[model samples]
Each structure stands twice: as C-alpha cells, then as structure tokens.
Target: MTKQDALFQYCLRLGDDALILGHRLAELCSRGPFLEEDLAQTNIALDLTGRAQLYFQYAADLEGRGQTADGLVYRRPERQIYNHLLCEQPNTDFAYVIARQLLFSAFDRFLLEDLCTSKDERLVEIAAKALKETRYHLAHASDWVYRLGLGTGESHRRMQQALNDLWPYTGELFEIDDVGLHLLEAGIAADLHTIRALWTPEIRQMLQKAGFEQPADDYMHTGGLKGIHSEHLGHMLSEMQYLVRAYPEATW
Candidate 1:
C-alpha cells in the first residue's frame, strides 16, 4: 500500500480498537461492582471514546471523502471495522474485564509512549494524550488483577480462567501487517516488535504478583486487522450503529 493508504489503515485500526474497547467499558457503567469503580470505568470509557474520535477525525481528513468521525464509527459495518479481537471480546465478568484491560492497556501504554515520537504530528499528539490515560488504565487493571487473584479461591479461579481464555486474543495486538510495515519504514508507526518486547515482561510480572502465571500461547486467533471479526463484534455493531443507521440524516 502507498504511504497515505497505509496511514489511513493505521488510523482506522487505532480508532476501531479504541471505539470498540470504549463501548465495552461503557457497557459496565452503573454495573461495576461498586460506585467508585463504576465511575472510574466510565471515565476510562470516555477517555478511549474521545481518543477514538481524534483518530477517526484524522483518518477522515486523510480519506478526503467527506466522512466525519462519527460517520466512520457509527456508520461502518462489522466487516469493515478493524479493531483487535481482544478489544471486542465480551465483558464476561469482572475478572474478564480486568484481564482484558490488563493485557490490552499494558501493550497500549508502551505503544503510545513510542508513538509520542512519531514523525506524524497528529498521531504523535493523539498518542501523547492516550499514553497518559492508558497508564492509569494499566495501573487500575493491575490493581484489580492483584486483588481478585489473591482475595479468595473463587475470585482466583475466575481471574485465572479469564486470563487463560483471553490469552489467545492477545496475539493479534502485535501482529504487524503490510500497512504497519509501510508506516514503520516511514517512521510514522511504533514498532510492534519493540512494543511487544517491553510489554511481555511487564505483563508476566503483573500476573506473577497476582498469583497467576502467564498462560501458554496456544492457537492464537487472528484476522481483525483484515476486518474479519468474531460474532460478538457484529452484535456490538448492531447495537452501537442502530441510531445512526436508523436516522441517517438526523443531527443534534
């Protein structure tokens, strides 16, 4: 792909990942185990959704097709969206929620930190802001993983199960394709190989602290970057895009 096309795909993937994960976290609003945590998850959701807007707006500008950020998000079909599979995984439980956040946010933090130095000024700006929020996200998830894993037998079992089940999805986060390679060559993208190098040890340490071991990598799932997604993503898009699909011309 040409550099412009690569950049557009890059932005699309980033925005898709953030938007899907934000929606998942938003689903937990008012349903968190407690009030304070509820508000915290909501705030994180807002942070991610806002970041997704920034990326989508950049992508829209790049596409030059008269698309707005909202249009890109709310008007896209599931097969056209490119979020990581891990991000779209359901919030099966509190343990599952924390496990998802722990894995994704840990990688995101390092990736955003590297992106702060990107040649693309807009991406650098977005990554700089997102890095700050992702740090908090990682910390929050780390704390919960520790508590839930050590608190009781049931919580420990649940936490371990979540980690194991989600482990396969983690592989997709670092899968760099042609678009990524082009951006990497142009100095506009963070190196996933480098990011993975930093992410793995930190995750292993966190799991160890939580009385859990890193789940063995077995049968990793793929295809999100190419727009293939799980059934859950289709269900999520059906709900998330309903308003825009139903009222194509309506505006606030």
Candidate 2:
C-alpha cells in the first residue's frame, strides 16, 4: 500500500480505538460506584473522544474523501472499524473495568510518549496532548487495581480473574502489521517492539504490587485490526450512531 494508505489506516485504527474505548468508559458515567469516580470516568471519556476526533480529522485529510470526523465515526459499519478487540470488550464489572483501564493505560502512556517524536507533526501534537491525560488515566486505574486487588477476598478474586481473562487480548496492542512497518520506516510511528519492551515491565510491576499473578500466554483472540470485531462493537454502534445516522448533517 502507498504511504498515504498506510497513514489513513493507522489513523483509522487509532481513532477507532479511542472512540470505542471512550464509548465504553462513557457507559459508566452514571453507573460508577460513586459520584466522584463517575465524573472522573466521564472526564476521561471526554479526553479519549476528543483524541479520536483529532485523529479522525487527520485521517479524513489523508483520505481526501470529503469525510468529516462525524461522518467517519457515525457512518462506518462494523467491518470498517479498526479498533483492537480489547477496547470493545464489555465492562462486566468494576474489577473488570479497572483491569481493562489499567492494562490499556499502561501501554498507552508509553506508546503516546514515543509517538510524541513522530515525524508527522499532527501525530506528534496529538500524542503530546494525549500523553498527559494517559498518565493520569494510568495512575487512577493503577490505584484502583492495587486497592481492589489487595482489599478483600472477593475483590481480590475478582481483580485476578479479570486480569487473567484480559491478558490474552493485550498481545494485539503491540502487533505491528505492514501498515505499521511502513509508518515506522517513515519515522511517523513508534516501534511497536520497542513500546512492548517498555510496557511489559511497567504492567508487570503494577500487577505484582496488586498481589496478582500474571496469567500465562494462553490461546489468544485477535482480528480487530483487520476489521473483525467482537459482537459488542456492533451493539455499541447501534446506540452511539443513532442520532448521527438519523439526522445526517444537521447543524445543531
């Protein structure tokens, strides 16, 4: 594929990841265990959704297809989305929610830090702004991981179970395909190998401190990068894209 094509896919994957994950977090807005934490999750959702918008805008420029961020997000079908399988997984419980957040944030903090040096100015700018919020996200989620994992017997069991279940999906975050290789050669992307190097130890330390054992590398489930997704993503889009699809381009 051309570099332009690679960049478009790269941005699509990034934007889709953020948009879907933001939607996941937003689902917790009124349902957080308490008011302050509820607002915190909502604020993080805003940060993620804003980041998705920035990346989608860049992707639209690359595509030159007259697509706005709203058009790209709301108008896309399930087969067109490129988010990771992990991001679209349902938040089944608070332990699961915190485990998912901590896992993603751990990798994201390092990944965005490296992307800050991208040759692509737009990526660099977006990464710089995003890194700060990701750091906060990691800290918040990591604290909860520690608290819940070390708290009571039931909480500890739940936290460990969540970690074991989610570990398989973590591998996909660092999977670099041809598009990523091309972007890496152009100095517009971080080396996923390098990012994984940094991410592994940091995440392991958090789990250790939480008194949880890291799960073995078992059978893994992937395919989201190639537009294959879990059933949850389509269900999410039904709710999220309703107003945008129903209204087309109504300027509010």
Candidate 3:
C-alpha cells in the first residue's frame, strides 16, 4: 500500500478503537460505582468519542471518497472496522472495566507519546492532544487497579480475574503488520515495539503496588487490526447504528 493508504488505515484503526471504547464506557454512564466516578467516566467517554471524530475526519479526507465522519462510523460493517480487540471486550463488571482500561490506556499513553514525534504533522497534532487525555485515563485506571485489587477479598479476586481474562488480548496492540511496517518505514507511525517496552514496566509497577501478579503474556488473541473482531462489536453496531440505519436520508 502507498503511504497515504497506510496512513488512512492507521487513522481508521485509531478512530475505531476510540469509538468502540467510548461506546463501552458510555454504557456505564449512570452505572458507575458512585456519583463522582459516574461523571468522570462519562467525561472520558466524551473525550474518546470526540477523538474518534478527529481521526475519522482525517481518514475521510485522506480517502477522498466524500465520506463524512458520521458515515464512516455509523454505516460501516463490523468486519470493515479496525479497532483493537481489547477495546471491544465487554464490561462484565467494574473490575473488568478498570482492568480493560488499565491495559488499553497504559499502552495508549505511551503510543500517543511516541506519535507526538511522528513525521506526519496531522498525526503529531492528534497525538499531542490525545496524550493529554490519555494521561488522565491512565491515571484513573491505575488508581482503580490499586483500589479494586487491594480493596477486599472479593474485589481483589475479581480484579485478578479481569486481568487474567483480558491479558490475552493485549498482544495484538503491539503486533505490527504490513501497513504498520510501511508507516514505520515512512516515519509516520509510532513504533509499537518501543511502546511495548515502556508499557510493560509501568503496568508491572502498578500491578506490584496493588499486590497483584501480572498475567502471563504467552498466547495472545489477534485479528482486530485486520478487521476481525469478537462477537460483541456486531451487537454494539446494531445499537450504535440504529438511528442512522433507520433514517439514512434524514437530515437533522
């Protein structure tokens, strides 16, 4: 693929990740464990959704196909999306939510930092803005990891279970494919391998502080980058696209 194609796909993947995770977080709008946290979570969801729009607008511009951000988001098939698998995982519980956020935000924090130095000016700007939000997201998740992991016997157990269940999905975040390789060669993409190095130690440190063991990274799930996703994404799309699908020609 040409550099433009690779960049387009890259933006789409980033946008997809934000959109799905934002939606997942939105599901917790009024269901947070407490009032302050409920508002915090909703704000984070908005941050992610707004980020998705930026990335999608860039992608649409790159594609030059007259597609709007809303069209790309609401009209695409599930298999056409390129979000990471971890973002699509369900919020089974509060512990599960924190664990998932911990994994994703930790990596995203470093990834966006790396992106801030990318050769592409647009990517650099997007990354710079996103890194600020991701820093807060990482802080929030890391705090919860400690709170839930060290809270009580049941909370600790649930936190550990969530970590174990989600660990397998983490590998895909660092898996570089052809598009990524091309972008890397052009200096337009962040080096995930380098980000992985930074991500591991911080995650380990947080887990250590929480009196929790790190899950083994032996066999990880994959395929999200290639538009392959878990069953949850389709169901999410069904709900997320309901209005758009029902009124394709309606303008508001």
- The estimated TM-scores of all candidates read 0.98, 0.97, 0.98
Tell me each candidate's RMSD, in Å, in order: 0.9, 1.2, 0.9
**Using lDDT as the measure, which candidate wins?**
1
lDDT of 1 by residue, 24-63 (tens): 9999988999999999999999999999999999999999
**Mind giving the per-residue lDDT tens digits that candidate 3 earns over 65-110?**
7988988999999889999999999999999999999999999998
- Candidate 1 TM-score over all chains jointly: 0.98
- State the lDDT at 81 in candidate 2: 97
User: Which pairs of residues clash in candidate 1, taking residues 3 or more apart in a chain or in different chains?
Assistant: none
Cα lDDT over the full model 3: 0.93
Candidate structures ordered by lDDT, highest first: 1, 3, 2
Candidate 3 contains a number of clashing pairs equal to 0
